[model samples]
Target: MNPIDTDPPPPTACFTYGSLMCEDIMAAVCGAHAAYRPATLQGHRRHAVVGVAYPGMVPNADHRVQGVLYLELPDSAWPRLDAFEGEEYERRIVTVETDGGAHAQAWTYVFRPRFAHRLAPADWDFDHFLRVGKARFMADYVGFDTLQPR
Candidate 1:
């Protein structure tokens, strides 16, 4: 009997904002067949702050955060992703606008301000996040510590 047989598959719609935005991480976290779509959430911004379990931190605000929306993933993978994120972040229903101008309601993680703070950078460094910080930061979602340096 193989342990692989006991574990289920991954989820279909797993959104990636940080390191997971990179194709390689996505493939590793989810699976080969997972497809990612460029999507945006209106009135929400991504910030780097308050270091915790994951890497840095991700907190939402009135500003918008640009990210890639993953397709629905297998249910089996949800637990791993959820555990990686932890309790500070809560899964919520959100509307994501795709490049095609279609709005779809999906689940996303949000950090509580009472436990954390807002990200102060004028804009989030998506490229930098994709390259070095995403994977480390996204392992856990915490409130913002401060803004990214200019």
Candidate 2:
């Protein structure tokens, strides 16, 4: 399915597979009350790489990618995530399946073609990422003070 759709009316949920999976990262962008559920998407693969805290998604030759489904956040959070990821990533719509078999629509970041070839394994050590990377990303995110910066 081609998941990309125009912004949904206020109160929309997004699926995050990278740094956003970290609670601190979510809090930095979506606020402390933001909620999320474990979900998985098909036909994509998550890779691990060195030098990055989050995993990278590659077009799966034979598998699906697993990720978390975040609860809808205020429209204000969009720019936060956008700035956190920068221009190399494009927000795309994707359908994620919950363990209970319900389907939900959400946004996910995908690498642009220009960087696709350059993306290596994400080196995604979940334990390390959750414990370390999450905090670091949030510190950097919140440290900025403003998305546009002065």
Candidate 3:
């Protein structure tokens, strides 16, 4: 008889650079907590979205974005995450390098091409966000209460 194969499929991974990098916000939106690590994505830039507390990422060959890589999120999380990202972003797969220098593929929300004009000229600062923006973002972002899974 042939040997039985019984390995579970790997979970989907995500790379987040903005407010979603905060575990509190991520759990509140996705309804699950995930293990995460520091990572960097090449050929991209993270910029402050004008008049908002969060940032939006776009492709920029000259830049690299530092973020967090979340692992093993339950399948149920994607729809809520998608709803939270709204029409302004489109989720796509990209490769990221972990702090340990290992490369992995993960999904990331990228700002849509039409909204590229909304990005500020300066890069978004994650430390600044933790210091001044997290509270405001958690309280005011309308998407939290209205996530309709598609």
Candidate 4:
């Protein structure tokens, strides 16, 4: 008889669109660099969250959001990322397209339905974030430690 093969599923890939797309943020969160590639998530619109600098994605058949696809993250890393995201967003499986015409499945954060009131009507601009908001976000952000269940 063939040997039984039993193992938990491997760690997952993550797709990041806003502040988490910054190497500085991910490195700080996970305590190391995570590999990533440029990819686009279709059929969703990313909007600015009310009273905050971060962005949130909502389903829109005609829209698309471009971001980095971080590959094969250790399951150990998800908690910190989750804490950093807080309850405002939920991780969901999404299909992304790379420039080479390849498609992939990765986990991306989406705005929680209960938190829908936080989304702004206008689309979020990553350029504006890189130009102005990114610095403030880096300086003032508290780590996931504070957010861990107490």
Candidate 5:
């Protein structure tokens, strides 16, 4: 007879490009703090979603998205993250390069193609997000209040 292994598998890294890139927002959504590293995803573009403060990521062969790579997020956090992303985004596995030039596999939320029309023509500016949009996003975004426990 053999004993069963019931422990959950190790957590994987998550690549966050928009509001989740903010440590404060990540902590609020995850219900705990996570370690992260500066990373960039190739062949993707980040654009401001229509009438929204946060940005959305889409595939673009010529572009790249700079974001944070959150390390080893617990399994419990995915439901909250998926719910927060809503119907417009889908989580997918992607390769990212850290600032230290190391490559890693990470799960990233991508803006659905059907919602492409909602993306503004211009690129989403992270600096502007940090400077101006963070406050409004934190205050008025309803997703935070509606996360259901898994």
Candidate 6:
């Protein structure tokens, strides 16, 4: 008889500043996702990644990036998200400021050191992403390969 295994607990939150800020995109990446709240990560700046539609975050002492804080993420979603993020981004802990004056600790992806060369100097714009880049991303960004068995 095979022994049964229990799944890991779901993630309570993650702060997203890139394409994942889009609910539709999140659903596609993580299948039936989580709740999100308006959030701003202080001391970081969002920059456009050259040749790609999404953005990457880098530390900046005086800058802040606005995004969303996702809540109740499913455990199954992390593998897919981690895969989609690839080695270019590293998951890290950070505190975010919200409209209601609340500060919350959440996980977010940041650009890896070697990949920093790919980040554009100008800050990435979220509203502009929805308007100009999202369509192309949903249609063409490379995803799913990481989920494949080795």
By lDDT, the best candidate is 3
RMSD of candidates 1 onward, in order: 10.3, 5.1, 3.6, 2.9, 3.7, 5.8
Model 4 weakest 10-residue run by lDDT: 141-150
Candidate 3, 24-102: lDDT as tens digits? 8888788889999999999999999999989999999999999999998899899999989989999998999999999
Report how far residue 52 has shifted in candidate 2, in Å: 2.1
Candidate 5 Cα misplacement greater than 4 A, ranges: 1-11, 142-146
Query: Candidate 4 has what TM-score?
Result: 0.87
Question: Which window of ten consecutive residues has the lowest lDDT sum in model 5?
Answer: 1-10
Q: Give all TM-scores, in the order shown.
A: 0.66, 0.76, 0.89, 0.87, 0.89, 0.85
Compared with the true structure, all predictions reach lDDT values of 0.59, 0.69, 0.90, 0.82, 0.89, 0.82
Report the C-alpha lDDT of model 1 over 33-97, residue by residue, as the tens digit: 56679988876666564442122234446567677787766664555555544565666667788
Q: Which stretches of candidate 3 lie above 4 Å from their native place?
A: 1-11, 142-146
- lDDT per residue, candidate 4, 25-79, as tens digits? 7777755577888999999999998877789998889999999888877766788
Whose lDDT is higher: candidate 1's or candidate 5's? 5
Q: For residue 30, what is the lDDT in candidate 2?
A: 54
List candidate 1 segments past 4 Å from native.
Answer: 1-12, 31-33, 51-62, 118-123, 131-150
Worst lDDT 10-window in candidate 3? 1-10
Query: Residue 147 error for model 6, in Å?
Result: 4.3
Cα shift from native, residue 95, model 5 (Å): 0.5
